[model samples]
Target: MLIIALSTNIAMLCLVSAVLQIVLPNDAPQWLIFGNIVVFVACVYYTYKAVTVWPDEEKAATIS
Candidate 1:
C-alpha cells in the first residue's frame, strides 16, 4: 500500500517534470531533468518488482 502510494506520487512528479521539460526546454536545468528521469526509472523498476513479489507475499501470509 505504501509502495503504491509512493509510486503514484513519483508518477505524478515524472509527468509534471516531463511537461515542464517540454514547455520550457531551454529554461529547464539539465541536472533536474536528469534527476527526474533517474527517479522515474527507479520508481518503475521497484514498482514492478514489488508487484511481482506481492503474490509470493500473499501466499506466505496465507500459509502462516
Candidate 2:
C-alpha cells in the first residue's frame, strides 16, 4: 500500500511540475525536469515490483 501511495504521489508530482513549467520562466534550471522524470520512472518501476511480490489476497482470505 505504501508503494502504491508513493507511485501515485510521484505521478502527481510529475504532472504538477509539467503543468507549472508552462508558466515558469524559460531560464529555469535543467535538473528539475530531469529529476522529476527519474523519480517518476523509479516510482512506477518499484510499484510494479512490489505488487508482483506481494502475497495473493484471495489466498489469504480463503485461509480464514
TM-score for all models, in order of appearance: 0.70, 0.66
What TM-score, to 2 decimals, does candidate 2 have? 0.66
Clashing pairs in 2: none
> What lDDT score belongs to each candidate, Candidate 1 first?
0.80, 0.77
Residues 1-55 of candidate 1 have per-residue lDDT tens digits of 7996799689679868866896774777778788887888888888888887776
TM-score of 1: 0.70
lDDT of 2 by residue, 1-64 (tens): 8868878788778867865764677765668777777777787788788888888889989988
Error in Å for residue 3 of model 2: 2.4
Tell how far residue 12 is off in model 1, in angstroms: 2.8
